[model samples]
Target chain A: MKDKELLKLVKQAKNYDSKAFGLLYEQFVSKVYNYIYYRTGSFIEAEDLTAQTFLKAFDAIGKFDGQKASFPTWLIRIANNLTIDYFRLKGRRPEVPIEYACENCDDCNLEETVLINAMSDRVKGLISGLTDEQQQVMILKFNLHFTNNEIAKAMGKTEGSIKSLQHRALSKIRKILEEEDG
Target chain B: MDNKLENALENCITLIRNREEGIDDCLARYPNLRKSLEPLLRAALAVDEVLPEISPSMEFKKSFGAKLDAMVEDKRKKFVLPRKASRKRIPPCVSAAATKCFNNGVCNCLYLCCLRCGNDGCIRQQSSRQLTLPGKESS
Candidate 1:
């Protein structure tokens, strides 16, 4: 949706318009679900967290300000917070088994599927080694395609900090991959 | 870890992401850190390439939407307008706007008061107030 139209919807949603809120939900549900899925690595947990994120956003929509951060940015922030809370409550990050992650991709040849799953699993394993902040930055940057500015807003950090985090995270991942290759 | 090297690495990643330039250009720009940063950038790029995008299952999506609608309905019941106030017919737009506000989990009385005021400014003020409430402490 255009910024103007989204703002209008947000305004209406703020006034308690369920239909307008549903429109916002329709617009962002996939993105939010994808983001949570990447973070939690569990389809079931991602579904639950994604639902919680929107419910929280619904309850708090009256407070969203488009000027400070775009709607998706704000929503991602909420998703991130909920993911963190889930991790805290669970006391560990759940790894999605390669088989589980690859269950839906029936189009690929068997060998291609195996190769892709292996690479994906390797990449995710390496990423799991980074600090929480670094992992968050990498996922938001590479997976979600958030810009440094938007990420900074979502993560509540300065753009410079985000740049540094991304650099350090990438550097760490590179080192791990190099060691495996060697 | 060096500040200069970090800046060069960040710039290289940005350039690579944008497909603006090749690694040779980045290496030339930061000759001192090339050997260390080069492999890292390549590894980062490789990992970036392999990250998968997952979609929620259809059943989950349908169920979630239904669940959310039910929650909204339950909240609507909790904040129903009083009988005396409901007797005085409200403009469709105003009532719609007020209903929206109530659905947002705003206090029932506040929205009711705004509706009772029956002017654009009251609604606008209430909306502004609602916008600021959650953002003040957190943002």
Candidate 2:
């Protein structure tokens, strides 16, 4: 939806308009889920985190100032915080669940599934080895296609730092992929 | 040269993302940078290819939708600002009339209808004299 339309819906949602809230949920739920899925790496946990993110958003939408952040960025920030909290509480990072990765594997046969899962594991593992900020920069850049300035704002870093992080992350991943191939 | 490479990679990658140029062509545009940019570009593509943009299952969507509906309804129910309703005050004139009727044994019809009274405000009879007067309430 257009920004103006989204703002109108947000205004309505702030007023407890259920229909408007539902529209907003429909529009953003998947993006939010995908973001959390990457951060948490489990469908179940991602779903749970996604639900909490929306609930928290619902509770606090009244205080959301559109001038400060776009709704998508705001939602991602919430999901990111919740994912950090989940890790902090669990006291351990999650191993990628091949099962969830293969859940929507485009109906591939078993062999194709294995091949794809292997590459997915490699990519995820390489990314997981990066520092938290680097991983976030990579994910926001590659997965969400956010520009450097937007990612900087979301990650609370300067655009210069974001560019540095992205460059370093890409170089690291490329080095890993090259070594593994060799 | 690191800053230069960052800007070049960003520009070429943005071109790829926008489909304005192919990767090979973009890399070709920067021959000196190709060696630096090729592996990263290839690695980025590998990651993007396998990291599929997946959505929640229909089952999950249905369940979350139900949950969100309940939440919106809950907020709808709770959104009431609960204005303190101002009560309608009984008019002072009517109350004064009633109070006078309680205090005197006279009818309140004059105050009620702007007619004469027996010189007092109460629920009693009047004499057989029609004189313009104010009930105790008006007095």
* Candidate 1, A1-182: lDDT as tens digits: 79899999999777666777778888889889877876776667788999999999988987999989999999999999998899889887644333344445554345644655666676567777778788778778777777888999999999889878877777777778768889
- Global local distance difference test of model 2: 0.76
List the pairs of residues colliding in candidate 2: B106-B122
Give per-residue CA lDDT, model 2, range B1-139, as digits (tens).
2876777788887898789999999989889888887887887776666565667766777788888888888867765433222223567798889888776644444444434443554422333233326563333
Q: Fraction of native Cα contacts kept in each candidate? A: 0.43, 0.57
TM-score of chain A of each: 0.85, 0.86
Deviation (Å) of B135 in candidate 1: 70
How well does each candidate superpose onto the true structure, as a TM-score? 0.68, 0.74
Best by TM-score: 2
lDDT per residue for candidate 1 within B1-139, as digits (tens), equals 5668666766887897789988788788888888877887786677577665555666777788888867766665555444436767787899899889777655766677676675779685865575565647433
The local lDDT score (0 to 100) that residue B28 gets in candidate 2 is 91
Candidate 1 backbone overlaps, count: 5
Q: What would the DockQ be for model 1?
A: 0.22
Q: What is candidate 2's lDDT per residue for A6-34, written digit by digit as tens? A: 99999999988888988999998988887
Runs of candidate 2 with Cα error greater than 4 angstroms are A94-119, B1-3, B81-139
